[model samples]
Target: MKSLGEVLIQRGPFSEIVIGNSAIVRAMLESGVKVVTSYPGSPTPEIAEAINSIPKDKNPLYFEFSTNEKVALELAFGAAVNGYTSCVFFKSVGMNVVADSFVQLSMMEIPGGMVIVTGDDPGANSSQNEQDNRHYARLSYTPIFEPKDAQEVYEMFKKAVEYSRKLRSPVVLRLTTHTAHFKQKVSFGVYEPSPTGEPLFDPNANGPYIPIAQNVPVMKRRALEKLLRWQEISENYAFLQGNGSDVGIITAGLPYLSLLDVLGESAKKVDILRLGMVYPLPRKAISEFLRKHKVVKILEELDNFIEEKVKAIAYEERIDVEIVGKTDIEDWIGEYTPEKVYSVMSKFSPELVRKVEKPVKFVRVVNRPPQLCPGCGHRPVFYVLSKLLREKDISVADIGCHTLGFLEPYKVGQILLSMGHSTGTASGLSMFNKDRKVVAFLGDSTFFHAGLPGIINAVFNKHNFTLVVMENGTTAMTGHQDHPGKAIKIRQILEAIGVKHIWEVDTYQQDKLEEILKTALETPEFNVVIAKHPCMLKFTRERRRKGIIKVPQMKVTNRCTLAGVCITKFACPSFQRADDGSIFVHEDLCIGDGSCMVVCPSGALEFEKIETGGGAK
Candidate 1:
């Protein structure tokens, strides 16, 4: 079994099974991508992970996890303008952060070509919302591609890069959660290694990259012209499939694949047009297809992007096809599945509906609520906060693993909007609600991302609220990616920002943390508390990698009176109550941090040394 890195670098006309994200990287290497930048995000982080898997010495392209999506796009844009094929990727909502520059950049020409990959979450599976980024492509006048599976993800990416270079414009490659995670056997072509030599940079080669008022009209005209050319080229583009049939199905991305899965052999009964180049609509091809079919159903996820466009084309061309988009049977929300397609297709062609064999019932599954990791660093901080804070004390939560504080026994987080909004939201709350103490929780990764501005606002305004900056040493929520905090200290930033009341304490030191919280809450000024600790999962992994086997394991002593504080209030997943009504530590789950001892009022928790086969006790 070759590692992902080994598989990625393998050359020649061989085939390997890989996920869509990995396939995109293979496509990048084959397309001779010179630079890749991204902010770690779900359904797309694996793209960066796959690139990182390749050793830095052997890696063909330059890659970096930028501070945020906007920074990531700018880095890639710089490389693209300097005559190097570049790519930047992020999740659905990340498009919002990059939109400020994205819309503007589309107006300018990219000589080296650029591909903006957006891993759209149709179900909001791991995102804040299910945004259809195809709208961004339409708004920016950029060409876009939507691949059905991992195999198409590979081929379309290569085409996208080439098309971007030919058109002298950036292209958008959109993937939903289903397509991004979908795996298939993809045949590979020979790797095209990037040419040797530094790409020459000319600031004025494209002439006036800025989009000021004087240049706006010229840039807009150029963009419109490019869009028209793309529309013409798209008419001949080999994205649509299938032949003549009165009953037709027009779809793109994952929904197309689902339609096929539902129809199976019955698909031959209807003509299917799967649009790979989704933005421009391939107006001519679509109009011709509508003319051939008496009834057409537009199957798509999230929004009626394709459906509405096809209908508009029909309306303009005066085609008499009965076009059906989102109906009462199907919704525009969530990922489309074969079952869903079957349900919708039955409305049009009941005879074509094949009986789907339902899988037999196995063991009944129980609903388990999400909770913090067994030895999470945020657990101690949240535990202490829950113990100390009054009901009137409002705690605002930012994005990260710490956001889980809103669930279960802690219930520390009252409001959460987006990443790094906690401090700003808390400021607003503090101004109006003078009687309550507003404490905003922020993670280290978020502090560098967007929290700094909020903190600065707090200091300048002298808002009376305690801001707890949980320094867990990495972006724990998004797969432990490194941030600016690895080099620069958060406390130092606070001091430089003129936050006079700053207290730094270890998160595991409950006594010190509790004392600091008490003092910070009573200060009646802008108070910043830096609770510093590395994420336990990352810390333990590093320790194991270094061959350090002996670790302190906590045990439940007989003094535990079944008071249920550890189970009810603290709720570390490690502590379990047996059927016999006795409390004990599940060694498999326990990381032996012993932070639970502080919450055990009976002094029943104690640490004991344990050694594995690798080292001495």
Candidate 2:
């Protein structure tokens, strides 16, 4: 059978040819990382998905989209203790959510080499905080390796296992968005399984599994002692070296690439040292390099991580090499654009000017910052549910791509902090009044994520509220990534949850959708609505041009006077407000997907026309 890598390559919107990062692929195949887990965010997702799909042989395979970052980390740590060389991953802020579990994992040292891959998003385009996570490795005192690009990412994975097994520490391989997402030539090779040693049971040395009063202090000491070796490892860092230093710049990961790109050919003259191992300051290697340099410049993204470490090492060593960094230079924490890096360099030495070109604005296809899809299934699902709101609706939402539901037309999602809080929040809201309809909506991904436990709580505790699990097969909002419900029937999940009154609906079918929903409202039974369909735009929009989505047509009958009640309360962007304060919809914008037809209580708003070039025929 073809490897899973072949599958993604055949089906993808990947920028580069998907063949580049096969080294990591080969490593997984070799190591047999049987337990794979992730919080379905970007950059790090590919590794989780690819590792999970690896042909499970004798391996007791389990792959999951953990509800939130914290839960995902907990699962991976649990698997590690149970004797699996498990690999768990999340984006940088993902670390923030899972900090509690992470600190626990730090307390319970790894028996097998546990690799936690945290992909840093630079430039703040996709992420909330551009705070570099190398500091987490510093704070946690976990070993960290900063891979420059895909190839380096693969190399570091192999190294991570070796370092982890030897040190008995969980090694974090930090790859930036540029490094994680961008494809480059990575040589394909066979995977190396984490060496299965005898199950380590050192009761006297402090229990590795149990975080007891006796063991916690010992564990902390071991973690710190491992961190203290950063300088030692730096002394021999083969990757962290450059020639006779006319000017030495110490940079890590993708930031190093930007500095090199800015310098162009002149970079060959200026000594450049790239550290794949960042948190363990590699102080020995760095201090040696500083001795040879006439002047030292620091290049790190989003934080004074490397610069601060370098300065501290310099201060201790008393080596006076002028540090050019965030304090004296740029204040902003983000990826150094070519201009920014070049400007920093030009200031240091007037001769390094090749005058980097400011990029011209090319007409790149802007990702329509997610509004409801022209013919999205979620539209009708929420349409009928909105009527359940007697006074006003209060909801707690989870993260995933479905956060888009709160945007324009389907302003249904109320509060979204992180993943899987919707059900729990609804439980809290239920306390105020059973009359106040609190609807909690979660996508298939989020349902799998943090919602299941909360759902179980609601089911077990008999919480009085309606819970709607919008099981759109794909994790639509975050680029249609896979979810467990992607292939599996959502009804199966609801059944597994032991919910009796589960209502399944074809959201495309209008009358039946609202009818079932209407019955569900008064039923007072804890209901589960499995609105099943692929995100039409995710698959459909990518193929042929599906025309603008519109609601069903309702002719102006006897009760029709332009009250515009439907338009005012339920503000859908598709509805056009006329000059006379009357309401009309632009038919061309309508994809003939009649979701707006719901909540029209009077049956006034229906699909009027879907025209070619003119009004409806």
Candidate 3:
């Protein structure tokens, strides 16, 4: 099978092979986007991945995995200011990181135009929170396109780029998790490479680039003016219209699919207003539809953003239509599916709607919640910390795979906020709760993304806390994407930020780690312990890629007391216990990190080195 990149760049006289996410990339290429940057995130990672995989010669567009969303936006904004078509993408929560800059840029002019793709996970799938970012468009006074599928994503994204440049502002392309990941047979156009040129910033090209106090009101007025103009254009965008009927359904984004599926054949009896432009309400079109229909029902996920607008429009126009929105039948949270829509629509027409059947047998499978992978180096560190802290002390957590420490076996983190708020939150706790010990935990990728600011804030405020930098050398939670601080030691960054009393220890060195942890807790000054370990999964994959395969192995070897210490305390997935309580190693799962060897109290586990790549020595 061709990689998403290959398929995207291939001359597509071929039909129906491209996925929704790749279609965005293909559209970017067709739109002549010169620069693309993103912080790797679910539902949106494939966009950056596909771009990164394109051969340099085939498509000369510049691409990068930025340190964080803010940087990603800034880089794209910089390119856009220089008259280069640029785009930046991230998941919904990541928008919070870029929000400050995004709001500011919205008030400025971009000659080359910039497209911001925000992937919203309505179900909280693989995310800390399910944020509705359609509000962002309304907040920023920017035009937004919410594509229903891959083909729409392709067509709308192309138009978005052009619209951005034409309007001299950034355009938002809101992609929900459903649209970002769901595959469809999208008929796509061929990739057209952007014109070859060295992109440079012409300072004078776009004047008043900065957002100052003097320009704030001017920018605000201009934003409103543009929104009004775009609202008229959106009214005529073809997707906003409905069939002439007394009963109508108004929906946008992924919910539109549900509306269609639920209505099915009866859809012809009712008029439907499918909104591709979710924000800056297309008032003229919506009012006309309301004037025609006696009842208008709104179906949307997460929030009543569209519903509220529809209501206001109906009232403003004195259209005597009954506006039904956010019924109790449909949940205000989670992604909308066909079944969920049917439940809502059944309230109106029970005879027509199909009932969602509950599974008869309901065979309960093994409950396998996500855990730290087998051979994860953070396992040992977390084990020791959980032992030391117990349930008394507070361990503030940040975003990463290490956040798994909040789960069972190792209930390390008691409080978790956004990406970089851990250390800052710890600082506040340290100042108030002088008697209690405070420890802030964050991963390497998060440390770069938002952790640095918090660390600096902690130091400046003279707060007392011990910070554990889980240096796993990769963003393990969201694939093994490289972070800036991963390669360059974070200790240097900390020292420069005035955080003294820093201790670095290999995660495998349990004794040294314990000593460091004890010292950090004892010390009054702000302390940082760097538990450095390469993520075992990434290490193993790298070794395989290099064809250098010898790995350390271990066995329980009949010295087993069956105390259940390793199984219960360590919780490393590599250890498998039989029904008889006999513990053994699963060679397939073990990565030879050897951190577990130190924790085995019975000395039953013995390390055996494998001579070759494929087998045991």
Candidate 4:
């Protein structure tokens, strides 16, 4: 049968079939890795899918979509602990989520081979922060390997698993976005899938199956002692060997690739000490390599992890070789591209001099903050709240799509705090300030993530705040991930919260929404108002997929009062300010949700879904 590598390149929508991660997959399959598991995330998602796509019949390596990173880690750990080689993967920030299980395996120690793959997003591309996972390796006192490219990533996985089993300790394979996403040619090796049957077990007092209390300290000590052996393994290993030169560039991860891309393959004046093992650092090997060279440049990304350790070691050993990396180069959180590497290199040496050009004129596009998409269901609710605010009741809102309430025309929300804070915040002020008129606006997604705690606290205490949940049947933010409010009714949660006065509002019905608000403001009890509608941007998208959403026309009418309020707060992309400063829906962008109808106090905005030749979703 043809190899799997040949299958993907032939038919995958892959913009480029030649990438780093793809190469790594081919290598893992060749090496006979028996298990893989992870959650899907950018950059790292391919790793999990790569393993899963491996022909199950050809390779018995079981693959799964673990619910969360912890589940993936534990499942892989269980297999590896029993002596079956396994791989667990997750994004870098996920490390914090799964840190609880991280230190324990090292404390308990692994009998089989285990590799924890972490893909660090340095530039916050699709992450919460730029965290260095290598520190986790050092904190756990385990070895870590960093590969710079696809070829290295493939080779390192085999070495990492081998090292983990050989030392009876788990190893971390710290992958970065650059290394995980790039494309490069990788040499192919052939091997049919070979399954390592059930893992072997040794019945001993201090074996992996031992109780936590009796064996943890002993395991920790053994893990520390095993660190000493890593230096020998790293130096003697052919993959990480340092060549002869006065300056030895001790580097790891993609920054090593950047430096190589900068230097190119031609010139070989300086020996590059490409370090795959980053944690417990293989100190003996690095120290020996540095001592032999006149100077060492630690080319790495983000914090000077390796350089800092190397500098300290050099100081302790009284080695005269200077460790220059972060100290010599500017420190910033970004991937090390060839341009940056070349710029740094040219700063000190003239061999790789490149010309600089003057800055070119560039147009500055106005960055309007994201508001409700054209025809969004969330807007009509805001329009009703705006009418309420303009007429009688003043609303306090929470953090969400509704948070745009504070942005313009509506400014409905006076305050926004943790999840469903508007309800409690408004309630606190309403009770103390004795303001009987107030409503709190929050999104369906926010209501799920942290709304319960706030609502539960408020309802029990009999807080007099009207909580208005914009229940759009989906989490609009974070790309429409599932939410409890989506599966279960939002009213169910409110009923459980013990809210006394409850009513549902169809945001599409302007007159009814206004009438409900009029009654809600007068009664002023611990009330719950849920506005339900599918997001216009999202709903019409489904119709467009079925080739249904027709071109909508803007009906010219004199009935429009031209309420500037719609333009201000209910800032839908579909709604634009004309030369007359009148807000009109951008017909091309409108999805016919009929939300603009609620916003026009003067009945200006109207829906006219007229069929045109074609319209983009």
CA lDDT scores, all candidates in order: 0.87, 0.67, 0.82, 0.68
Q: Which portions of model 4 miss their true places by more than 4 Å?
A: 1-41, 46-68, 82-86, 109-112, 165-168, 185-213, 236-248, 261-270, 328-330, 339-567, 577-588, 612-617
Please state the error at residue 57 of candidate 4 in Å: 9.1
For model 2, where is the 10-residue window of minimal lDDT? Answer: 11-20
* Candidate that beats the other on lDDT, 3 or 4, i.e. the better one: 3
lDDT of 2 by residue, 1-617 (tens): 66654433332223223422334544554555656677767666666556555555533346777656777777877666655677778887788877766765655656666788887887766665585787777677777877777777766787777766566678787877777776765554443344444444454553656667877787787677777765466445436446575688887777677777777777767787888787777776787888787788787777777787788888999987787776453645556666667766677765754667876888777455555655677766666555545547565566755566676545677776556778888887777575666777777777765678888888888876777777667777655666566466667767887888888877867678777766666666577777766676675565454563343443333344666544554444456666876667665454554555655666775445545567666
* Count of clashing residue pairs in every prediction: 0, 20, 0, 7
lDDT tens digits by residue: candidate 1, 1-617: 77898888877777999999999999999998989999888989999889999877779989998888999999999899888999999999889989989998778878889999999997788887788899998888988888989998999899899989887789999988888889999998998565655775675777567788998998899999999988886775535566566788888888877787788788887888778788887998899899998998888887888888899999999999899888773477677887777777777678887756568889889787888888888888888888788998899998888989998799999898888899899999999776788899999998998899899998999888999999989988878899999899888899999999999998889899999998998898989999988899888888999997557778988888889898998898888889898998887788888788888889999987565588646
Clashing pairs in 4: 19-183, 20-182, 408-569, 409-568, 409-569, 560-604, 574-586
Query: Model 4 Cα displacement at 357 (Å)?
Result: 7.1
lDDT of 1 at 115: 97
In the predicted model 3, the residue pairs found to clash are none
Model 4, position 469: C-alpha lDDT score: 80
Per-residue alpha-carbon lDDT of model 3 for 538-616, expressed as tens digits?
Answer: 8788899999775777778788788777778888877888877789888888776677877777788888766657765
Model 4 weakest 10-residue run by lDDT? 8-17
TM-score of 3: 0.94
Q: lDDT of model 3 at residue 313?
A: 83
